[model samples]
Target chain A: MAELELSGVSKVYGAFNALRDVSLQIADGEFAVFVGPSGCGKSTLLRLIAGLDPVSGGRIAIGGNDMTARQAGQRPVAMVFQNYALYPHMSVFENIAFPLQMERRTKDDIKREVSRAAEIVQLSTRLQDRPAKLSGGQRQRVAIARAIVRKPGIFLMDEPLSNLDAALRMEMRAELTQLHRRLGSTMVYVTHDQLEAMTMADRIVVLNGGRVEQVGAPMELYHNPANLFVAGFIGSPPMNFAAARVDAVEGHAARLTVEGLGSFAVSYDGKEVSAGDAVTIGIRPEAMLPGAGEAGHLSFRMTPETVERLGLHTIVHAPVGAKTFTALFNGDPRMARGSALDVSVPLAQLHLFDRNGAGRSIRDIQ
Target chain B: MTFRSGAADAPAFNQNLGAYLFLAPALLILFLSLLLPAAATIGMSFTDISFLRPTNFVGLDNYLRLLSDGRFQQAVFNTSYYTLGVTLPTMVLGLLAAVALNRRFPFRVAFRTIFYLPVLTSLIAAAVVWVYIYEPYSGPMNGLLVSLGLPPQPWLQSPNLAMTALIIMAVWRDFGTAMIIYLAGLQDIPEEIYEAARLDGAGKFAILRRITVPMLSSVTFYLMIILIVQSFQVFGAIYVMTGGGPLGSTETIVFQMYQTAFGYTEFGYAAAMSTVLFFVILLFSIVGTKIMRKGEA
Candidate 1:
């Protein structure tokens, strides 16, 4: 196992910049996931790390050795493609043994290693079957088995679970976490699914528009996002946003006039904001508690337009001045359509952002 | 339920009838052009019908004679040599050209079009051009050989070299077709497969030998059947360039059949040859298709 380090790595295609000055380090035995939207340069970064593509600028080092000019075949890395990329003509045994065969290992050694990988992925019984004959999950296991058989220092997965169904994706996510624990090898996975990153990654690197937005543990990012994009992207149903103006500033406390929600006193650790400064306020849907009138809490009135009862929680979607405000309540609540409900959130849970989409909240400052 | 079923049945019947109407023209053409000639050839093979004599039933007489005819046996051997020589080399050259041209390079489209021009040329025109190129005295082939300090040899005149020369020209004219088909097959393979191979530590030649060739097996099988069937009927080129000359060294089954029917007015014997050739080609096609299906499975 080895750590991966990329410094100022950039990729440019003609005039389009696919990745811009991306630099990060993953510790040995760490499961780091690069998460972003489509075309956010997550997959491009993975390809660069795999040495499948050359960087337009900067250097890459694996295990503290410079690997900038090495070919992909010469790198100490193995990759699992999004579609598995199993050789359709080969049996599972052959596919798993491909890397060993490329190294010209003896017949007995290849058989031993392939069987070990197959056993790890629970595919030993189906070793002789062609990839076309296997189900989607089984094919994914074959790909993982192939990567494992190589015993590379680093494993790169490019959205490997995206092709599986929802249930299978969940199962594979848990399996991958267990695999990471068992292997204890550095893995850099790229995905557009935030849930997958949140569940499986030891650290999640959030990317947007070819640049890194934030990198932190899952709960750390959830509790304190670095910017407006991370705040909205990290949580399900996302965080609600509302425009607000600072009415007054008094010693790390701001009195703000929130649109359609009246004024409130919120604490901050940053420099005093001048009066009449514009800022955005955010509150998560799940953070909204039922009923209002909690002293020192931020409260608002919303007319529910749609109510979704998903067994444990009732998600109430309502309109508050041209924006959709969602309030998730524990268990099922008696929420009716077009009825105004008083929803309150703890004042400490509020997120404040500058007009530039940069986080300027007390939690972020801490 | 009965009323809905009755209403749906009428439209379904009309839809099928319209489909059949659309298919009728092509089916009729196939029957007239292919099935009719095949049936007539089979019938004529059983009768000694020719311009030299009155018609008479001669069941299995022509077949019995073919088993013992030395000229027909020589023609069969020449045809097999030409087919094997042309097909194997054409496929190999075509696959190499396709793999080289599959990459993005300057003027790739221009190069592809240049390689494909031979396939679009008329067969007789191509044959005539090749004959000129193989012209012994002042042809480019001999001139290049002379420049390279090799003895100038007669390309189409020597009996041993005559079949080889025809096979060379046929490959040059037909590898373009194989290349075009291979280029299409190359497009169907996913790009990620190559990336995975590279990450798996496979070099360029290994990827080609282990991944590319195996992946294109179905396409190869298809091109093989086409080339075999077409080469088995190699008449036009040999007719234009060799005319079954050089001691009948370059004569193939179809060329001999033409000479038998039109040259000597032996229509009954030629019909027997045609029937035999048809069955051979059909057997090759059936076997090829079966192997291709197994490969797919």
Candidate 2:
């Protein structure tokens, strides 16, 4: 277990920048996940930490030792790749025992460690089988076991469950969480799936365009995002944004006029915005109700376009004015297409962003 | 519309007809070129068939004569020596060269073209070029040896060195085919397997031994079969370079077959030698296939 730190790490390929001035610190035995869309440099950051790739600038330290120029084998890190790159010729036992063999351990020590690692991954009976004989999930377990036998200071996983099916991915996600708990090893994982990041991470680092947007606990990001990107990216059905203009500014209260809805008052004392400034209002799907009779009723008429019935909950897509929005309901609603209905947007649950897409803190805004 | 109950049976008949039509040209070519000549050879092996006379039945006389002929025995020993000497080294060298060139490098295409150039050259032409280079007095090889303070010894003119010279030329001219096959085999290995090996803490040599060699067994078997069969029938280089000279040290089985059938007009003895050579090649091929299958299992 170690505390890994990256200080001003940057990777440049010719003239194109893959990562720029990215710095992060992961404490000892913490499970940190890097989440982003494709081409956002999440995988590059993980590779840099794993020493699989070189950093063009800045330093990387593991366990208080600077290891910026060390090779991947010299670094105290083990990586489990997305493809589960099991050696095709070796049996499962050989694959897991390879690291111990490299360290020149005795036969008894190698055998005991390999079996112990395999038992942790529930692969004791599969030690004699080759990789080709295993299923996708089993191959992934073998890959994880290969990493665990090394007893490295940090575990790096680069989208390790992306190749498995949905059910297997979920199962392995839980298994990995449990593994982290048992081993108490510092782990840095990278994935494009937000759900995986939210469910499995002690701290989630959201990246966009090769830059770190926010770093916080999963629910911290959900409840209080730092920017428009994190607000739109960290939820199941994404948050909705509508253009609005500030109507009136008073002490701690600002009236805003949404494009389709009527004018409403919002608390905004910390925000430096005048009365006619442009701002965007964000609302979660579950926060909006399908009724016009409410105290803070920012109501609008919309035609229900599509209704997705997902057993426990239903999502209704409705067209208001020229924009489309979705609302999540607890049960199935008997709403027909092309029928007009009023929807409410709660004032406290609305997120406000400036013109530059930076979130105005709800508490700071008041 | 009525659903036909026997559509499956109709497809089966159609499939057989289609398969026969697809195989017609290959089967016809095999019948004309391979099967007919094999059947004629089997018949001729039992007879004394001279070029200008009626074929006379010899029954086992050709086989009996082959057992007593000293030149034929020398031919068989020389052929086996050549096969063992060339096949193993050629397969090993070709595999090494293929693996070295498999990675991305500067001017890789040019290197491949240079390596494959010898295989495209005619065997007679290659032998003629090598004969000049192995000249005892003024050849480039002897000159370099002399400059290096070594004795300038005869290469093809010595009985002990003539077979070695021919083996060198044969390996140089034939290793390109093996290299190409090994290159294809190396490419078939998925990149993920190599990545996994690195993660397993395997160094370069261990990965080559534990992963590459085992994966390329099939290609090795294929290359050995072709090299062995070709070694048995090595005649063009012998004719162009040594003519089985220098006390007949380089006289392989095929060269003796050519001399007996065409040089001395002894058709029955040559046909007997050909049959024996065919069996030798067939035995090697079957053993190679069996070993490869066992390795895979």
Which of the numbered candidates is closest to the native, going by highest lDDT?
Answer: 1
TM-score of chain B of each: 0.95, 0.91
| lDDT tens per residue, model 2, A82-157 | 9887777779998888878878899999999999999999999999998889999999999899999988899999
lDDT of 1 by residue, B1-297 (tens): 122233644767666666678799998999999999899999999888897879999999999989999999999999999999999999999999999999999999999999999989999999998888889998999999999999988999999999999998888889999999999999999999998899899999999999999999999999999999999999989999999989999999999999999998889999999999999999999999999999977
Residues A245-314 of candidate 1 have per-residue lDDT tens digits of 9999998789999768888999887663678988888899998998985886888788889999998999
Docking class of 2: medium
Number of clashes recorded per candidate: 0, 0
DockQ for candidate 1: 0.87
What DockQ does each listed candidate score? 0.87, 0.51
Error of 1 at B294 (Å): 1.8
Report model 2's TM-score to 2 decimal places: 0.93
